[model samples]
Target: MMLEVAIKHAFGGFSLDAGFTAPSGVTALFGRSGSGKTTIINAVAGLLTPDEGRIASRGTVMLDTHHRINLKPHRRRIGYIFQEGRLFPHLSVRQNLGYGAWFAPTPAGRQDASRVVEMLAIGDLLDRRPGALSGGEKQRVAIGRALLSAPELVLADEPLAALDEERKAEILPYFERLRDEISVPILYVSHSASEVARLATTVVALEAGRVVAKGTAAEILGDPAILPAGAREAGAVLTAHVKTHHPDGLTELEAGGIALFLPTVHAAPGSRLRIRIAAHDVMLSRERPEGLSALNILPGTVHSVRPGDGPGALVALDTPAGRVLARITRRSAQTLALSSGATAHAIIKTVSVAASDVGAAAAT
Candidate 1:
């Protein structure tokens, strides 16, 4: 599916002139809070009308200011999941989900109630009311409701923003499962680098209401020029296969012929996983250092070394395990005589990689 949106609008002294196209899988609209992420999503959802341009999905034009074509929110086959679950207080979980399906213009008559229920792991909570469920459970119910509607696309606007850290963590795997299992494409809006790293297949980076960048996850997220949330978030996301689980509760991952040790995860052997190693966590050496605490040592040549945003510089290394970036002080970089094409070893500690920082590397 292809979602094309081009919109122009002004509100509260803020001007929004945004446009982008998203292909199949999850395409994240990423930026700061006021960068017009919601404005574009609303336009696509038929909630806001643009002064000009059109919104189309899979060849069907939802809104066209030039042609004077605008579809009502209900008429547009798009499912919206807000930050809050917004379930009816009086309605049971099943009832709330049923309402979503009931409102669909052309319901999937052969209801896949059991399938959705299992997919979201909400079968146990079906009889409970919204007031009785926890935040994560409520969101799961909400997602199930949206899926049951059988919409052509799902628009998620900061779906995890309102949840606490634990709740957010609890819900992330489910989101991943939905991405892998659901047929409908998702246009996810988020400001979180971790979430985008884990979930997005494509990314449309917005800045001051304009699309500053758009590309595949690896292409966009791997760019050192793109500002990550923090130094710890600065790194390339790599796709690797789970080689095996260790007795010490760690899993060995194989990426581009290199082995990465991570915390034991639910993924089994041969299953793919995404891992991110912070640039700051990476230490470069001229030669293989002996007796180091760091478990992973990669052999690579310096691809490029360039000045970074803050006081440090970004050194791009072409490793057997794929490209990795290391952030080092300018002084250290100069002292090491670092330059493009220099051979080096990237040393990374095994425990420095946290579970929250790792995402599924393969996009659905």
Candidate 2:
């Protein structure tokens, strides 16, 4: 484990008692509003001292309430990126990046500024101030600044919450790049399922200040029962390679020998991508239907069925591409006799997959 956190704190009506271990890649603290996502990240960054418990990185303890040891925020050697860029207005982008480097204990330990600038593609904006940059550009610089600090861990608290859709699209790929190219582990907090699906390697799901589930991104997102956002946010991530592009503006992808067609993906042929298929967008069929307008279909066996308190039921299918989820009503389940070991076909419309749900696959 790269990061270990176990903390408990209370303020007013809400109480937080959460603990989890994060491995080398991006570990997302996922939940809805006021679910202790921010609180946990703050505790890890040494900004908020927990009433009890401890936090450590790479076996070095940053906080231990029992031992009366609580390092200050500056001494923790962690970089924090807020919802907004929070760059210094008086300084140019170059100076703002250098500010992070100043905190490094030794000059030799700092990241190469030119390499970081090129990786984030912020070299062009280095001469400008924060007031002149767009939301996405500012965030890129903020990430660059954090990288230059040479910290052991990075903490991002809903970094995209302040951006609109277009700006979010612009910033997400940079985070993907950060996750793949950077060696430092990240403790990212977010309530957005799409963002979590696109970026998280390990998921620590919180609900009302408790860790309800923790696992790989695929495991937590695919299992509807464990999803903090319920069935609406339930989905599975499929790793596919761009096989070809059609003249009709559809891109063909191959996943485990299964063919999937989607809207024209902005990627070159043979490029790997992660596609998030929402459970609500999928339909189950006992037999493969014909003359359907949907362009994507997969034949698989029913793995499990979880019926909610209402009329809806979530079904899991073992498909060639990967684990796929379908949200159907109890009536439909009974009508089709859906149960474990039953054969079914999963149908999906090509247009149902929004552009944001597809992202460049992180390096394994």
Candidate 3:
């Protein structure tokens, strides 16, 4: 385990009692506001000493209320990235990053600055101050600064929430690189399902200050029952490789022996990627339909059907392209006779898969 946390704290009228183990790769704390996502991360970073709890990273104990062994924030060796870049406005990007490295306990513990710059592609902005950098560029520099600290773990508190959509897109690839290339474990906080689908390796879902579900990204996001935001945000992350780019501006991807066509993907052939397909965007049919404009279709069997309190239903299907989810009206589900062991076809329009929902797959 990379991190183990069990904490309980109460502030004002709200109470938080959550615990989970974070393995290697990015572990995301996912939930809505006031769900104690930030509180859990703060406990890990020593920003807020919980009323009573224990936190350990890489087997080193950072907090143990029972034993009264609490390490100071700096002694914990945690690099924290806030929603904003929080870079020094007066210092150049290079100096800002150096500030983090200077805090390393030992000279040998400092990360190579040049390599960090190259990984985040911030060498060009080293001479510029935070005031001169864009939102995306500033966030990149913030990430570089954190890496230079040589910390055992990195804590990102909704790092992309402060950015616009365009800036978020610009910064997401850097985070992907961080997850794939960096060996350090990450504890990230976010409420966006799309962000979780695109970046998280393991997901710890919180609701009302409690952990409701914990599993792989595919397991948490593909199942609608546990999602706090409900069916609209439920989706599946499919791993696919770019097979071809057609003349009609469609990119062809091969996923688990199934072909999926999507709007022009900005990746080279053979590049592996993760695609997030929303449950609401998928349509179910008993038989393979013909003469349709939709370019993607996969045959699968119904794994389960869950009827919501409302008029809708969520269906899970076991397909060649991994698990697929569909949200349809209960009336429609009965008319089509959707149930466990029933065969069906998942029809998806190429254009329904948004550009922001696609991301680079982590290297195995």
User: Please, what is the TM-score per model?
Assistant: 0.94, 0.97, 0.97
Root-mean-square deviation of every model: 1.9, 1.2, 1.2
Candidate 2 residues lying further than 4 Å off, grouped into runs, are none
Residue-by-residue lDDT tens digits, candidate 1, 149-239: 8888899999999999889988988888878877667999998877887888888988778888898766666677765344445677778
Worst 10 residues of 1 by lDDT: 225-234
Write the number of the candidate with greater lDDT, choosing between 1 and 2.
Answer: 2
lDDT of all predictions: 0.84, 0.92, 0.92
**On a 0 to 100 scale, what is the lDDT of residue 325 in model 2?**
94
Q: Write the per-residue lDDT of candidate 2 for residues 48-119, one digit (tens) a residue.
A: 888898999977899999999999999888989999999999999999999999998899999999999988
Model 3 bad stretches (over 4 Å):
none
Q: Model 1 compared with the native: what TM-score? A: 0.94
